[model samples]
Target: MKHWIHNKLAKVPAGIVIAALATAWALGAVLNEHGMARQDRHEVVRMTEKMKTVCVGRFLLDLPKEAQITFSTPRIDGFTVVIFPETLDEFQTRLAEREALIKAKPDRLGGDRNLEVAKEVRGDGGMTGKLLVHSRAVKEGTASNGLEIERYRHEGVAVEALMHGNGVSVNLASDFYFPDMVGNVLKLAVKLVPNPENKVPAEPGFCMDGAYLRDPLTADQLEQITMFARLPSNPDIRFLLILAAGLQPDKDGLIERDAATKSQFSPTERMRFSRLRAAPRTIGGIYGEEVVKRVHELNDSIVYSFWWEVAGTTDNIFVPHIVFQMDTGEGDHGPVPSSLSEGAAMGMWDRISSSIRVRPTQPPERVAAESPPTPLGSYAWAGERCPESGWWQCSDGGNGIGVLGGQRQYIRKGERMPQALLLPPQTLWEKLRGVQPSFESKTQTSWKLVDKRSRKRVPSPLPLAQATPVAAAGITSAGTGPSVMEQQGVAVGSFAATGLPCPASGWWLCDDPRALDGTRWFARGSLLPPATFALPPGGFSRSANSAKSIERRGAWRLVRLADAPEQAASDDNGKLA
Candidate 1:
């Protein structure tokens, strides 16, 4: 058979023989590549156990029970948390290597990249801490022709403080345009308490009698928090979570659809923008959009990135933008090989993304009226259920109601707070909020309970001549005239005023002193009517001629969409009858 084949090949043209061999080699290469991709495509992910909840900013997300989580507010507008699938010691090795590489970079561009300041200091509560300051000097050289000035300097100074206690360490970093922040940064470091639980301790932990690190960023156009996790069985597989509140939004408090997302990519990025999945998704109670793309590079390696964002509003801290990115591959710039199959990566994303939700401040069945009243100065987010009905002052800084001088508002318990537009500063007000050149950004306001009296209260029966002015008695309308929707044309929290047309058709919560009937269905474009409360039979009977009932023009807030499944479960009329 070999002799016969050789004779046949001799009879064939040399060119044809060479062509056949080339074709076979090409076919084999294609098959090898196809097999590699298939291996990733069919990888299976088995979530063997129930998920555990971890708090990230104003929301909660479920993860594998074995995942180790750490929380940090690395930036004023950002919160970051890292979850390790393996033991902390194993992850530390990877981090140590990365840090060493960063430290080895040679100084260039007429600037020094040396660690100029490193010292150990004792913080409050006997906590030991290390202060690190890396400074790059401002370099000024003679102009090219000695006519102009040539200057080079890094943008800002960074002060990092690491506190060690309770077998855990807390890191806090601050960036300042000047070096004057060192003193304040030290002050902040001493006040930090490293509690592994990341919760407000019932009693002091390892820190002094001061506030632990929480949401301390009060700057406008600044909102960020990040969370990262990896699989314990496969530390190479990782997940990242990011939240940003300063992204600009439309009138409805949603990110400006495609334009905003497209702007995230530069010219080179646009070329690699291999879209995989892009659609609308609602995580927690906020309405937002998402885009998932697979990155195919020149080296034939691949990466899958996910982007999601919601509108920034004056109602809650869970506004602006959020992202969930996953990496299932080896690091250290080695050969790009994913640890998990593509199917496994997508399956994990679906499981965790679906579990994202606003952390419940109260039980679902707990009625606002029945719950204990929230005291003055208590803080609440916009989307959260109002703990007490009264006046709330927006402390989110120069945004929301402040743009129109209506920062303090009357909001009833059980009613959703509204949203407002935070006009970009035309002056130096930008520096006041930390980040200058502030653009139009939507962020949830941290509202504080200021008053405990509602507008249009049910007055006691008194003779007309003796009736005193509500304001004269130190009780005035907390209602700031028009709603944020009416004044700023931006609904703070998807809410509509009583006289305004309903922004959306849904169950609207009545902002009444007494939550009358909780929520009622309302149609879009229809005027939200007033909520009437009947007076108790003999509670206010100074005379038989006294008023028997009172009507309050309360603002109506959209609680649920008209298409919710529970809409059909109720048979009562869609009014507070």
Candidate 2:
């Protein structure tokens, strides 16, 4: 039967066949064009000057505030980006009822020869659904035994789920892909939350539904919305705004240049196309290319179109391809001149497109996470318990005059104050003499508290001093071979200068007779910081009482050894060091 039909067709002339095919194609194209919805020439376009903030997906943008907005759902995979003009509570309640209705239906796997239920998934945000995989058994080349060999073709899988977040809900579905595209799309939906109160995790992720969610697809995803103007006067005039973001078309579809590519059109088609403007433009910090065109249809109708698109790639969640498009034509038809003037459409496009921007996403800190305050300027002395938890500044400048890290340390409350390294007198002299001095010594020092309100506690620096102290060996004078007292063989009444390392562990008496702390325990090798005096109940202003008013520099005389009987006697007077 096939040979007989082919023999009959081979007798027909090639020119006649070509003409018939061309006629059919031309007839179809003409019918399709005529059947399309046309713009009503009488209807005029109008717009309000007021604008409002519209939150769609994870982004926020300004729209005509007074423009009536109606929500519609388009079949989009991976994400459902939409703006519900209703209150969050209202939307949630309605969404819950819809979910309940779906749940009431009995589950039954349909008996189909070519389709099978691969798996079912249930999760939060109404993510309860099943995946369907397409399969078909086909007979292949026969085997040597004269038996037919059968093979199965796995034609991918598909899934759909309801995702709830950001005050609205949408049904998320995915197109069929070999490696369980349904599961991947569901994973993205499961991570979606309505206004998430958590930090955005590192990438292979994106912000959606007012929260950051992991996007399993390595490919860039795009979503778009077509906003139609409601003009009662010109009901048929189609003036709509199209806003889209994320992935965009490459060279084809809406992204292709219409007027510039007239070379691809016939002479008659080229006569009806005109390019008004095409250039690089920047809106809301996003660099994108723009194009404006006028289309003159064969039916004597005119249409205006505008397009702006940003360049982007995968893994760039922060910088997605933002598209702002406007058209004055019928929805189904290619383009038609609308009652709205081209000038007004351009003005509206500029006003709305310039306002496109990524919404600010700042994670808020919980009030309970804040730490207790540590008053600055609170002072603690060496060998005494720290009064507060915070960074403390030591009065003793460690040997090198003003070293960076050594002068400050973070200390917690109730911890014993460790001594600071003393700045040797000889070291100071060397510095005064324009010479660099180096030394390491620990001496009892006064510490002033400092803190940041945002940080509850400051971390301690690298090993400065031991938590437990061992018996100290004798101290040598700074830059000097030996102290005069050490040479004279006197263990008691040894002199130690302020800001200098202590030569011995003993009860050191302040040389100043009127000082509040007459004598204090000194650990050998600890720096002898200036003696401190208790200030009034209310701390004096810095202008009224300088740092000298609270602390004074004076020589310290080792009155008694720390392990001696006299040293124990000093502790009996409630002065434990």
Question: Which lDDT tens digits does candidate 1 get at residues 177-229?
Answer: 34533444544455455555544343321211122443343335254566777
- The C-alpha local distance difference test score for the whole of candidate 1 amounts to 0.53
Error of 2 at 529 (Å): 55
Q: Measured by TM-score, how close is model 1 to the native structure?
A: 0.36
The residue-level lDDT of candidate 2 at 140 comes to 38
lDDT score for residue 11 of model 1: 71
The deviation in Å at residue 475 for candidate 1 is 57
TM-score, cand. 2: 0.39
Candidate number of the best lDDT = 1
Question: What is the alpha-carbon lDDT for the whole of candidate 2?
Answer: 0.52
lDDT of each: 0.53, 0.52
Model 1, runs deviating above 4 Å: 1-45, 48-50, 66-73, 77-193, 198-223, 246-274, 294-303, 311-316, 329-331, 334-342, 362-577
Query: What is the Å distance of residue 269 in model 1 from its true position?
Result: 12
